[model samples]
Target: MAGKVQKIKDWKGSEQKGTLKLQEAEVPRAALTDAISEDILCDLAELFKVFGDSTRIKILYDLFSGEKNVTEICRDLEMNQSAVSHQLKILRTAKLVQGRREGKSIVYALADEHVKMIIAMGIEHTEE
Candidate 1:
């Protein structure tokens, strides 16, 4: 039952001769469906999927410093131009990063604060 307390076995080495003590715990329920819609969930899943790529993560981390052209990104990451551009395209489609024309190159950067915050949170969580 949602939000109901129930007694369950502790599974620790506290068992008695012929009986076991039960611990009171709350059973988890689906809490997200009430707060998020299916479409939003799908979009969130897609957003995370985009983050699943290592190349994209590197590009985002590079952008965290400041805007840089694809050539700069390629040099910083030691990757080729086309590979970096492809990852940038995915990041752009996910709205995690953006680019602008500077001279003859497109200088890329994180789209907004939320992106930087997301990556920062991920770093913090991993360290924890």
Candidate 2:
């Protein structure tokens, strides 16, 4: 049933009698497939995957403030050079951030204003 409410049981104990609880029971919402476009779903999955990693999240946070070279980012995070470089590469590939060569180093920053907003929104959501 698409909208039929039901309850199963909790891990702690058996199901309480006479309680019609809508638990994790898989009640398929037929409208969901219609509600979300494929493109939107793909984009959301990509965004979540990008944000899933602690290293990438930190990299985004570092770039959120302003442009910084790999060395600067490494120092701030107290991470190794190669580790920071790897995360930066992933962020760049995702187009969440971009970098330009400055002297001997490539300075990275948020590719678009949306990036900062995305990070801010994430922080706000998780903090709450």
Candidate 3:
């Protein structure tokens, strides 16, 4: 099988053992220019950074079921109120979640359908 494999000119193998090779490709300058702007790229990076935390992921998973207040989230996830609030602050800043005043407490939920889609896709990928 190794002998039957074909190699491309733009891909080069690394000298180190058990490491993957790097592949280079040329894309049109027009396409590159029309691609995401630097500011948007930075914002996207910031959004993904929020998703990188396991605690935040748990909070998000619970929120997926329905909206819940900080106290409820803490109780359901077995996390402390302060810790949940801190994570909620980060999630809110990233626009992944939003909260609304409900009587004496604020109920939080996914910010938009995009948040649900992101979480759904992540779960699908992991299951596969």
Candidate 4:
């Protein structure tokens, strides 16, 4: 498969670490030095932490195409209800999955464009 795909590598704290907007600033070089507050890295690390689990990855994979209830995910992935539920709880807390009450069941879907794009880019990387 060959096509256009958006890709973002894990931030490799290079010399050019911050975004380009900061890079283009007309301020002095010393002022241009990125003095990152410790919390910024911590928050970014937490973002990756959400993607660091196999179970969570599977939950995202199962729902990649569209929303699905617990039963649908369990049945499609051949997982037990407890197993799917546990993974889903983690995804929900990460804000990676959104749940809505639909009759007796809740449907879960990817929470944002960024999550979907990252997953798509990951797929593309492996495919490449």
What is each predicted model's overall lDDT from 0 to 1? 0.75, 0.72, 0.76, 0.70
Task: Answer with 1 or 3, whichever has the higher lDDT.
Answer: 3
* Cα error of candidate 2 at position 2, Å: 35
Best by TM-score: 1
Where does candidate 2 stray beyond 4 Å? 1-36
Per-model clash counts, in order, read 0, 0, 0, 0
Residue 109's lDDT within candidate 2 is 89
Point out the higher-scoring one by TM-score: 2 or 3. Answer: 3
Ranking according to lDDT, highest score first: 3, 1, 2, 4
Q: Candidate 1: worst 10 consecutive residues by lDDT?
A: 11-20
Superposition error at 119 for model 4 (Å): 1.5
TM-score of each predicted structure versus truth: 0.72, 0.69, 0.71, 0.67
Candidate 1: tens digits of C-alpha lDDT, residues 17-100: 222233443334444225788998899999999989989988887776678999999999999999999999999999998899
For model 4, residues 1-128, the per-residue Cα lDDT tens digits are 12233232431112331211111112344433558678977976887888888777878876766789999998888889999999888888878899999999999998875575566556656778
Cα displacement (Å) at residue 11, model 2: 39
**RMSD, candidate 2, Å:** 13.6
State model 2's lDDT: 0.72
Worst 10 residues of 4 by lDDT: 17-26
The candidate that achieves the highest lDDT relative to the unseen native structure = 3
